[model samples]
Target: MKTIKHFLIALMSIAAFTACEKDGDLITLSGLEQSELMATESTVVLTQETSAEHALSLTWTTSTLTVSDPTMLAPNVLSTTLQVSASEDFSGTIQESVESSLSHTYTVAQLNTIAKNLGATPDAATPVYFRLEASVGANMNPVYSNMITVNITTYEIDMSIGFILNSDQEATGATLYSADSDGEYVGFMGATAWYSFFLEEGDGTVWGNDAVSGTAFVTSSEDGSWNCWFPGQGGCYYVDFNTNSQNWSALWIPTLTVSGDISGELTFDRPNVKWTLPFTATSTTMTIQVSGTGNQYNNATGTDDEAAIDTPVAFAQNGSYVELVSQAGDITVTVPQAGDYTLTIDLSDPTAWTVEAVEGSEEPVVVNPNVYLPGVDDGISGNWTFDNALPLYNEENLAYAGVVNVNSLWGYTINIERDNWSDNYLLDSGDATSGTLVFQGNTNIPAPTAGLYLIDVSLNGLTYNLTALGNEIWVVGLDDQWNFNMPLTATATAGEYSGQITFAGASPWGFQIHLDSSWNRYFGGSSGSLHYRGSNITDDASLTAGTYTMTVNLIAGTYSITQ
Candidate 1:
């Protein structure tokens, strides 16, 4: 009886297993199907003028999702999204917006801005591609639609007409000067909305005026708020203003003409003959003596006084008018007495230039001999003070020369006044030491690298040069016991060194060339041609055990090893 009961239970278990298999088969046949989205339009065109009114629309069919269990009937929420991309592959500049309804619409302006934000040019028409995506429940499969292409035209602001400068003194449209696009017009102290004044007509006139105590010109709206105006009877002008710094300059359209005489007899000419006036920091007045053997003056004629009578002469003159040759007025100078006479010019007022005769002296102007290396980082801690500064003496070459141990790199300016940083000499182009130096507004000179170097500077010529100095050269390798102490000495010849060494070590042995028993300055490489402070030879040469001659050109910074 117990066995019969057990057989009945087994039979019941088999029946239950058959029912489960049949249910699984039904579920597989009725599995959930993924739905796809479709777009209403394949291509779209948009214009910048009416971008807000135009839009690209996309629509898609709803998707149906199913569950494995037939008894579990839960509602599935479908979420749809519209995506835009610059490329068909959707790899670059992609934007997506969630769709609440079956269709999504994007304004023309919105699409154009999106394209620009994704790296499209502002003024050009861009091709934009769009696609739709449909997603069911978190566990259900998502679907994608066919891609659509849209062409968007974007417009750029006309910067030429954005800002204009017009004065009440000038007729409407008669003298309307537009503002220049001189970068973003950053105003005084971070001010904004200030544009630079430019000329719309008549030689592109602009105004230049003092920012402080300058006249202000109002635009069309005279509501008490006005733009800065150019002082002095307004013709055509260019007004340059810095709203952030509150600094402004207004100059007449046509620059003022300035011409002067050298001895009440010589008249100045534009672009041809002009005296290059020299001035010192402390002197409120400047004097140029054009007598025999004095501060010589030249005219259209050559430097020779007798030759300069009828011919044009070129005189070195320095002032604000160096580039204003076209606008300066004719200036004349007359030399009454041929004897040594000094033409003293007053610098108090630029408008009224006066020259008077003074007694001339033949004494040579004495320049300070001691030169200090100011504004230099000497591998030490300090600011631009002269304390602990490097001093250079007048060498035989008439230039200040000295040897200095500098940091890996440094920048410095030269100065004759030991305590004054203002009276310093700097390079014409900042950080350029290859050219001549200037007394004012010069840039810092750079040191190529850290090492002992000989620095030579000529205050008179305003030029400088630097040379790296090395005391000794050594060749070390396995044959030299890999010790710097046991190295071959190089014989110096014409700024170069050459040495020969015998290598009896293993066929492939590493070797290097060092300077002064130190590795700081060394050269080693696979190529026969060497580089200063370059990498070492990783691949050892399989030279037969023999004597090899090595030559190093210190001045040229090259080396070679030959068997």
Candidate 2:
């Protein structure tokens, strides 16, 4: 009863362990939510002057701060015509109660001063306006603040015309003339100048079209201000002059040429060129054909005027990967791999060509590979032996009757044995004349001649003759105490041998009887052993005694003999 109780407890403990192992896990919670903010718009503006008593300060903030103030910015007349000073915190002359929110009112004096500077009169006909605009955060956000345009009679003058383009100037000696100040261009060959004149009608101003002739500088009087004038029905005008000649000099911009390394003694027909500006080349074959014109190019600044002409040429060889440039000929190159690779050029043809890695190159080049097979027999780029011996071959049928195909018969369960392995070597029976297994070694030993040889044995310390040309002999009834040393020999002798039979001990004595043909023979003796070497060649050949010539077939069977 106690043993049963113990077993029950063990079973319960096993069940508990299994339950704990299978139920060891807890629920896990995981997840996340994300929200994105858009980029804001960046803005720029120019102030009329730094004369306002209530100095304005521009404040900006962003999640990623990388913005610069006006004071820290460089002046680029080409990119921006207006210059803006740094913002100030001081508010001057404005009413004390006007400070609130993002904007404040200016005094009448400030407004008049600003207007005069902007070339605008205080009257309604030439009223000035206070312009207000907002900029995006420094994070390059796509969002923008509301734009404010307030037209007030009391306004500050804006000295900046905000003209981004420069006017063309014609000069002759000390005199310089500009087409923009002329109000209207003299008009192209068949063009005309026209304007919309303001007409007094009703309470507001009305306009009507008017055509005028002459080169007098006239602006659009429709708004009573110096606004640019338009010519023709479409209000587009162009300057036309028939001067003898106008010399405009431009700088020559250099183009870069890029190309991949090419291999072999080949030529790259077409190449390409790339420049900082668009250019049209003199030839269509030249890539990146585009033209660039500007005053910055007048003195041929930078690498202008210099052009690059590069093409891919190759002289591929065994070890070298080469690419040629059309401009510069024949440069040695090395590629990572052998197969198809590309040549990248800056100016010349950007495309690449397919190349093959071959052997026998004109130049001596070496390839350093990470991994390579050592001492191989197959042909490749590594060190492989070429003088190794080939499989053995036999010319004459020596072992079998008649002409023996040594290669076939020698391979037929043939083996060689030697007491000392110091001169060990394999005899290729296939290379023999009469299926004679040739012995070879690293030492200076004479190679065995190819011929038919019969394996013989001397019984009782005497050379015995085979019953047939290729027969095996075995002696029976020899005393174990006889001192007969067994000597196995191979010869072409044809005769039976008999002599004093001797043995060392009780150890059984035996000799191998090999046959040249496919036959079966048998042998058994009292108190002795018969070990036949040839396969199925021992059949007690029961060969009758007589001077008869017969084919000693390998298969075992007795037959009558005649002489």
Candidate 3:
């Protein structure tokens, strides 16, 4: 009987332990209340002058929870997060979390930076919503505190018409320098004048009463003005002006000069002309007066007083200047009369320095003739036959251009000649179709492929280009006004053609390609790949009102559209 009673006692102990384990695994809180959050200050004004000592503080009441099974409420770690958002819905929010904190503090500067990062306008009051989130174990649901609203006013200095330097005497001479609230110097180093500020709408009250030499100052007016006067010295200077207090200061900046070879040559007189030193900051061109006796060759302008030469003129030194003369050279230039004359020389172009008689100029000057391109081989004729050669038109960019007809099976090369056979130029290496033209002595440049092409040749630079004629491949459709004349030409490459076209009023715009400006042979299809000599194909894809790149491959018989 004692043993039977012991077994019953053991059964009772096991039942109690199992009951405890079940309760511990499934614990629940019967009543939970959201925390109350409040800010020490509902509205705060922040400025650049505000410091971290004065910060915005927020405090929240601790949350209360009623556990259904108090024994299961053992010590549990919970996370408390403070979230700040631009909208009340908590969209686009920034959060800070801690293990357990009833209060949080943010400096005025920190809050201002946050507001700015949130795209708040400067000098404006913006509302920010703040709330708290409390989270516990996986079995428990998260809780949130009541949201609090904060109005933050951020201050920004008004710099629309701030400090300016009155350097140049002209009415619009002032150069504006933006200043901070404390009136610190921060700007680019350049030359500008102070008078430019006068054009602004503000009154004279902006100028300071007391002036500090070489310093910027603000006037005592209600709408004050800032001004700085640079000293007589020519150098870089840093100037600053305080908007709150009308005070300004200037700091001189030292500059180091490094000497190098002068770019162009100059002359003041015959034989002593070439002055290779750097020109003055005022101007790159210089002028000098020349005087000679009467009877200086009666050629309207006196012959002895002025002269031109084929070779570069020599320099002759005077008091502190020099004169340029073409004597002992190709051509001699003369002046109109025996009276003193002013000659202006510009050395901007080292190869061709312009010399003109500004004071007493009479006639225009003459120069050398430019080169030209005769033409390319059409595969039907010999390379240098002038009879069938197409004359290239000079287009001034060191380039000569012309168009020629070509065949598919036979390729041709370019033959460049200057007037006669004395100087013949050709590509040293590279296919004339699409590679660098390294000029070889009297070598021929073979064409990249056979097609009607527009050829451009640069003889001096040894470069040439062949583009397939656009007129050979026409694009027609309602999108392009159904104009058979609209065509896409081959780019720098051989068989690929590209051009941009707009689909405006046409709905579901479509187009077809024609070969050699004729409808006799054309391409049209809807399967990305083009069909030769097919019926008019409607585009499976629709086009809107926008520009698109239309590329066609003649060899592959394919086309593509890209916006």
Candidate 4:
């Protein structure tokens, strides 16, 4: 016969029972919050002191009793059952909420394992409270203890700085750290951020991130700030704050200024202060002298302005000086050694000096008009109207007075300077206008120095033999009236040559070779021929005073006459 034995128990505060025979030894049990069944804590506070992020463990110790050994305590046969529940309140939620009511019997080994897995050592304070639970069949119960508290702390840092959104090179900023009493910064770590600046005048900026550390401040996007730094210390620098969520504090770096003047403490013997000047003159003679306040007064070789002009000017240490005498025009000087020097010149009256006398303190005296004496030519003087556009013909070689008439088609050598100019006719460098006009010798004559000249003409490749035509002079005039002497001459021979004789464009008509005395003129044809093109020849009426060449063929020609 089977007898039902009611085993009374508790599971999480609920009462229950299990049926079993007295001799069956089924070991019916209730859940146990504490393995040995003794508790001291009734509440737990999971304070901020818990460094561990997960759950905490609770435990207790007590001697157990068995039904069979009513007088003996069964520490050897300790049996246990457990139930668990979670709560938001720090109070005994394990009793208020019955998460699990079922009870499972635990062997002595199992009981110790449960306590060990819950982080319960022999006597660890384990300052968290959990309800003691017991179960038998469906019955549940909870046991409570006094309150226990735990302390835990967390770490946080604050960082602050300005954000440079636009990476402009001209815009500069700095990251500054708050300094301690000893000038050291607290928690000052490394930093990194991107930066960019212009590579060229109009190019896109180049950029990269840079990190640095110190109690000191750093410039971000350092640019255009007038500040001076040690070489290679400026430009642009990016920063990276190596900490988490911390802002990097910064400031726009201000620029600095430096100033000083060059002085003459720099002596010639110590270290030379070199200087030079460039110029051109009309005559072969000129004068140079250096005279100023400080080093200019020094006595030097080339510095003494005297006569017998020096080829390449030189100056020695001395007092200030001046150019008393020197070459006429421009002089170029290249200093091999260091020194100070000055230059000057005195230009002789150019061919015919035009004096625009403004009434001064003393009414300017007007000198007598001088006659133009061309060497080896008939001396003539008149108010000739001169064309300023002709190529450079050193007028110094031919002096003219009066209204100089310059009417002809002639290539110009154009150059203008405040002083006596030279034959500078070629176009300036990099000038594409009118292209380049090269002479027979590849000479680029821009504007020639202002002057007067005798125009010499050559036919074919040979200059005409002036003596062959009876020592008689023929004046080639670009006028139908034959009124003016066109400063023309000819030396001739015969060969294959191509050239254009340029006359002043002011002269309107074609060319006319007039016989000063009488002579035969020969041109394009067979031997001893006088050929005249229809376009070039007109009425020879103006030759009423001289002999002329006939257009018809000359039959037995070799003839010469003498008085």
TM-score of each: 0.23, 0.13, 0.25, 0.15
Task: For residues 1-563, write the lDDT of model 1, one tens digit per residue.
Answer: 43443343334332221112232232211222333555554545555444435466666666554434464332334567778888888886778888777776665555555776666666666777777766644544556777777666555522222123333222122121124644223111101112123222121223322221112222222233333322212122223333323343332222121233332322221111121232222232333323111111121221122332221122223443211222233333444445554444332222222444445622223234457776454565456555423232322233554445555235777877778778777777533226678886546776566655546577767787765666656776645356665344435443356767676754223566665554554554333444333333322245567777767654344566677
Q: Rank the candidates by TM-score, best first.
A: 3, 1, 4, 2
lDDT of 4 by residue, 225-316 (tens): 21111111111111222222222221111111111111121111001111222222233332322222211101121112231122322222
Which residue runs does candidate 1 get wrong by more than 4 Å?
Answer: 1-43, 68-72, 122-125, 137-141, 157-563
- Alpha-carbon lDDT, every model: 0.44, 0.23, 0.45, 0.24
Residue 545, model 1, lDDT:
70
Better of 1 and 4 by TM-score: 1
After superposition, which runs of candidate 3 have C-alpha atoms over 4 Å from their true positions? 1-26, 29-32, 65-73, 138-141, 157-563
The per-candidate count of clashes, in order, stands at: 57, 85, 48, 114
TM-score of 1: 0.23
Q: Model 4 misses residue 173 by how many Å?
A: 38
* Model 4 bad stretches (over 4 Å): 1-58, 62-65, 69-128, 143-148, 151-563
TM-score comparison, 1 vs 2, better candidate: 1
lDDT (Cα, tens digit) per residue for candidate 2, span 1-563: 43443343333331221111113431111111111211121221223332223322322222221212222221111110111111121123211121123334443334344434444443433322222222221222222222222333433332211111111111101111123432111211111112211211111112211112111122222532321222211111122111112111111122223223322222121112211111112221221111112112111121122221122222222233223222333323334444433332222211222233232222222111111111212222223222211111110111111111111211221212212223223333222222223233222211123322332222112111122332333333233322223222222432232222233322222222223223232222111112232111111222232233222211221211123
